[model samples]
Target: MAEWDIRKLQILRTLRDRGTVTATAEALHMTPSAVSQQLTNLSRQLGVELLQAHGRRVRLTDAARLVLRHAEAVFEQLERADAELAAHARGDAGEVRVGAFSTAVSALVVPAVTTLRNTHPAITVRVREAEAQEAYELLQAGEVDLALSLAAHAPTAADPRFTRVPLLADPLDVALPQDHPLASAEEPRLADLAAEPWIYGSSGPWSDITRAACEAAGFRPHQAHAAAGWTAILAMVEAGMGVALVPRMAAVPRDGVVMRELRADRPARHVVAAVRTGAGEGGAVGRVLEALRRAAGAPAHEPPLPGPARPPGCPVGG
Candidate 1:
């Protein structure tokens, strides 16, 4: 079996197009003797005569013409491959796997996916709902390209493995029964609710936020009910079970629940997107991050909140 070198094949193709060894050498930045050596080597490797003297110059043989025809298709395919790779690198086409928490899926991930579909139709975003720590674990294990996390739960900037992109600081509002006394207050104080029973997530970053906020207000929250999902937590508050601190992004207007802004202790959960240090530089990951920033700026039904400051060198779509 004979082996073919692409460089040698390219030389033959150039010679065929150039018509003479001197012209081919000049076009390829090589000496005429070097061009002749490559042609001779190619002919010997394929066990065929590729060129012959045509009066004052050389001409490609029929065998060489046949090889050049096939080589033309190979060159075209290589060019197409380069174009596709460039498109992927630019985020014009490719897939990004994202892991997010449930609330983030509702508030940020879903909207980002919709925006990507409308703008970068060739980019596919796959999202999975996972808790903050779990999302980070997925990113570390290469199971996801990007992960949405609460800032308190994310790794420090010093961690070499990941780059954090701050998205928003979702302010915590007090969810109350429509008829509750605090519901009518222009701005409720967290200290006033010290005696009230609290509805909170069973465990996780939200639970930690609730505990810290209440402690800051001079009382430990009396956890009367525990629910993992925001819908359930808000439902409990709606039924007059207890008051709950709900992040602005997670607040969905329900029949009996009214969200009141906290005046004194306006605790907020900072949301951030994390990717492998260099992974978010461009391509699908970069596009997804941009969409997330846009989504974070526009919450479903709530008043628009100020977006987090963009990190240095971070690219946010216009």
Candidate 2:
């Protein structure tokens, strides 16, 4: 078998997924005719019927299917090689693609990226804000070098396919309007505002943390609103829409909102930095991981501490 171009493998993958030349063309940003021509050329090169016509549609032949299975693995290996080579050429000049959960992106990721830029200027960092499971899939697919993930509960098993590094354990903080009375309190408890309407961030580890904290305080919070993004939830809080319990990271900054530590015994969710097994051990990913370690404030020999309480412009206390 002749060596296949990575671009052809990508096209094959797209064809396998999109199932139509038109859809695959759109995905690959090429004209339909162009995609068809490439497929024809690829088939001729392989000397096999890679695709077959079924009515107006097309489908992969059995031989194509077998080729595709191996193609995927080969393409992945090629991608890693390309990434590693790029990392080498620039003298640590590779790129680190990272997927992060909402809160992690808002708080630790931004600052960590800032540090990464200052330290390793040659390395490129591509970040995607994603949910935990989505990030995990991206990591598994080799689409991203690291995934910043969170769980309301512990993960099922520490699988050998990846390495999980605990970055931070951020507690749930209460978000109140700046004028709210409890906003200034050194520490507040869910019991303090049992009757107030609340904004919730739907269901997640962060939301679960809030619910459990409130339940431990002896009342079910009146769920006034539910949203996915912290900014939306915080914006509602800013408008005095309702008080909300969010991860400490969400409370980090933004005008017109106040975040205070919850005195309740429930601890915060753990934020994890996951890599594709050995994917991030060196090169650009390693540099970014180092910055993440610094931004998250986890020193090698020292115990972790809660990150600085928000940035300067974003007031926390009332």
Clashes of each: 0, 1
The per-model lDDT (C-alpha) reads 0.77, 0.70
* Cα deviation of 211, candidate 2, in Å: 1.4
RMSD from true fold, candidate 1: 19.0
- Give all TM-scores, in the order shown: 0.65, 0.62
Report the number of the highest-lDDT candidate. Answer: 1
Off by over 4 Å in 1: 1-91, 298-318
User: What tens-digit string does per-residue lDDT give for candidate 1 at 1-318?
Assistant: 766878998788767656788878876789999999998999999899999988988889999988777776676465445445656676478888899987789888999999989999988998888877788878865688888977666667444456677777777888999899988987689998999999987776667778888887889999999987778988898899999988777788999999888856767777788876556655666778888988988333232122234332212110
Candidate 2, which segments miss by more than 4 Å at Cα?
1-90, 151-158, 178-181, 184-186, 204-206, 252-256, 264-266, 300-318
- Over the full model, what C-alpha lDDT does candidate 1 score relative to the true structure? 0.77
Candidate 2 structure quality by residue, lDDT tens digits, 179-221: 9989888677779889998887667544565666677788888
How high a TM-score does candidate 2 get? 0.62
